[model samples]
Target: MSIFVRLLEAIGIASASAPPIASRPAPVGPIMAYNALDLSDPGLLEMMRDGRIGVSGLSVNERQALRNSTFFRAMNLIAGSIGKLPIHLMRRNGKLTEKASEHPLFNVLHRKPNDYQTASRFKSYMQLAALLDGSAYALKIKSRGAVRQLIPLARRSVKPQLSDDFVLTFRYTRPNGTVVTLQADDVFHFSTPLSLDGLNGVSLLDVAADTLGLTIKAQQAAARLLTKGTMARGALQTEATLGEEAIAHLKQSLAEGYAGANAEHDWLILEEGLKANAFGYNAKDSQLIELMKREAEEVSRFTGAPRPLLMFDETSWGSGVRELGLFLVTYCLMDWFVIWEEAIWMWLLTPEEQKTFYAKFNEGALLRGSLKDQADFFKAALGPNGAWLEPNEVRESFDRNPIEGGEGLPRSGTTAAAIAQADKPDDKEGSENGA
Candidate 1:
């Protein structure tokens, strides 16, 4: 029995036969250590391969720290927005087929991807990790030569390899001290800013660390002030003489009484001619808010996320919101959509099937506007002078069932030329009356 069969059986899947092997003894070549660690940095790859490095800077830990931040949480809006979109499978003739979309492949992707996480969670994690780490992996689970389900692998545990024959394989470390190798055909490796050699992706954190780190520091400083009462450039002064121990006791007492949310508006009695004075402004100071806002704006610019989408600017109203939404869908979301769609198309469909089948993200669904706005847009689209879409076609977009006889092209209002032609007598009738 092979290790894969044992694994499947351990997962409660009854396996009757051994899995088929497609790999030709990985051609005795140099093993590549293409992990999440920035390969662009020399020696890091070697260190990771030799187990010399463990969670360095910009590690998965840093990614989590960013998630914990206020401004960093705003970045998640991009991934969350795009990840929930529906992926449709279509044929070469541009026909969407239920067979393809309802296939087990999509069922696993759209509903239950793994035993632990839903499709939404899997997609959200995959997209965020890919954005931060520049690469994400999904291990293909198969039984008896057929793919059963896709399991998302932790970005931290996967080190990929590109063999001389261009065969991609991954070395994944499990939580129970077991290691498994997966073929490229068995794994869905999604990446962004894919390198020219295609061996590894360039981490966005590596490129934008200075910016992200600054925001992180600001958050930490604010947390310290809020929780530990370390007010910026402020200190307590006393006129009465006191022993060193008493002074230390007073400071600790003040901190205990006036720290965190519990300290709001709480009065403190002082003795020995001690008076409280505040020098620095509170955290609500516009300057600090502006600084954080500026940093957030810069991060949004780098990520191509709309400022309005992140709630950075509240002044945008009505059409501004629509325009910003369009900008997000066009400039930011579409790029990621294309990346995911291409990856799915290439991997889910074989070479022969690729000629006829493809995948696409439903961009129209994301680009939809308000009810009134959509109605007006559809009216213009269905107008006879500029007729583009039929009434039924428009209704289908709103998920409303098409009406009978609604497929015909609409007619334009009466024109002066048409009225004149109607009033004129027929030439053949006039000639027959004369004869």
Candidate 2:
């Protein structure tokens, strides 16, 4: 253990063990249900475990609903895109030299963090937070005097409580139920602030709560329709009086024979004068499908994720997909990238180091256009009026090695002639004067 940890332990500020069952008392005040100030609230952990959402009208848990819905998959795609990209530190002069680029800071970032998580895992964790919870948090683990590792904190594991002095402190609960009190500086927080509590972020669930609730209700209704037989709606009519056993047998047989997708085309026979009379067959089916479509589209619209991404809008295809993809990167993903970049710079780097170095996400990886688009872009970039990037830079985009003599730009005739004339300045001036 580090001296810092030992010092904290000595001062009785270290993480305390989980209290005994009898020792834990009932909470009080407005935060009575789950004490926001306390890290290891059993109620909080139980809510997380059950995936319970207090938001009314939702039949399902927020986390489960997000996973089951297309929005979660779209979020995964966005998160994965960012997580796979190279995020590195650049020097003040904008060069990525060995000293600046391959610093220990970057090594900790790109390699295993605290000997447990991979670089990709770390980035993905933050990405998930930015998308779903509107915040990402990390515990800054230090070795000696310098910051060494960053451990990503689960969104459900930590709660940020604001004191009367307007100071922020984190109440983090470990997996073993140990609650640790950490100062704001000890935790790295990246938040998309929508309220006064800048430490905690607004959940996407909270924003799309009503819509999600409606979605769940719609899904439940559809499941009921399917389980009760999609085509076999309405009631069974009979002229002859039936006994309780006969009615029970008939109900069971109908349910087993025609109830789910697997029993769709099965023969549903009603003996003993019991006739099956179906109602709302066509209208209900169409309405159910339409309701689902509308709900999915609503989710897409509210979340800023494209409807086409969730396969709800077939109209947006080909070039429209590309346009939407670019739009998503610019509007949705770019904002998230900035949140992460700024947080990393502020939290990871010391005040002095922040001046010399800054962290940036490689947006080019996310925004790279089509082959034709890239060709045109590179052509314009290498043109006489453009600031020509080296051939190695272009080759790197194509995942190819640089060729010898490819560093120099292919000069235009006008540029070459201008250069030649400029070299012979005296001759050029004399010729102009004689003329």
Candidate 3:
């Protein structure tokens, strides 16, 4: 009785222990990472709209680099967002001007003329033109220094000694535990006009249909918003109601629960991380900037990458403007690997399309052709891990180039060029070997 019965029980136990051979799909364990954006997931594209996802911000340089790559369109979508500042302030105080675009104040900042500048500077000037449409910018705070009057309005500011050097700069940590050092002058580049195709991972139609049916819904809501006043254009309302709708669309797309926004949530987590490293929150000082600043020390480090000490001659808004968060957005969109991974609206492209994608993502071709020495400098900015710059070293290096505007030019065109040259070597060696 015992031996046969025991053997049968053992067999039963063994059968139970093994995985079910051909059963219906069973529930898996909890999801721990950014699987919402996973392409293999059945509803990935559809989920992109349903408030379960969002696109991340891409930088200016990276966006342009991947403009023609497979991910370019998706990146544009991820990066586009709406920021709601006290919108009333925009009406009563801010002017409707193309400050960054047509009237980019950076163009007013002169540099020692060179081939790169003569060519590249014009491109920046055009960028300002595209963004602003030529409107005078309001000077937020008048900086003064004896160097203020330098010709071409070089970065020399003529600030009275009385003005406190209050804007602080420091290094911070990101959610992924990466380091990003930020200077006080680093601009947040709020979700103003996120029209560039930086977010190519998900489709806009998919996002609109999902997140509150937001694209069309936002347009309808913004169109209906009673809130309106003097805008920068000297118009009688806040941004054209449609413009407000677009921004709202953008902001909601980035907030928690937006599909493809797993990266953004991670970034915010990084910002909060700053709280552990330094001064405690004053909670009492409720100023928005102060509130934001309370979070800033931490934010700076979380998005931290090494700032390169570029060889330009400006400081105020030059290399010091664009910080680490923005750069991540830029690089991710233009990154060769990421773009190549998502080829053609989920269809996967042929080999020829991959070639074109690689070419566009490789900005080195343009840089090397224009400036050899400058290409070398760009190579130096790249970190050992292929990052545009090291988390710690970036701050000081990019400071050297002439900072015109159009997402603010780097001081070192040479640095950018240097990286480009190394990325793609000359085929001259192959020719020599053949000979």
Best by lDDT: 2
Instruction: Give model 3's TM-score versus the native structure.
Output: 0.18
CA lDDT for candidate 2? 0.68
- Worst lDDT window (10 residues) for model 1? 51-60
Give the clashing residue pairs of candidate 1, or none: none
On the 0 to 100 scale, the lDDT of residue 424 in model 3 is 50
Off by over 4 Å in 2: 1-56, 94-99, 144-146, 164-166, 230-280, 283-286, 318-321, 408-410, 413-435
lDDT of each: 0.66, 0.68, 0.29
Each candidate's TM vs. the true structure?
0.65, 0.70, 0.18
* Tens-place lDDT digits, model 3, residues 263-293: 6344222221122133233323323334333
**Candidate 2 vs candidate 3, lDDT winner:** 2
Alpha-carbon shift of residue 16 in model 3 (angstroms): 59
Candidate 1 global TM-score: 0.65
Candidate numbers, best TM-score first, in rank order: 2, 1, 3
Q: State the RMSD for candidate 1.
A: 12.3
Q: In order, how many clashes per candidate?
A: 0, 0, 101
- Scored by TM-score, the top model is 2
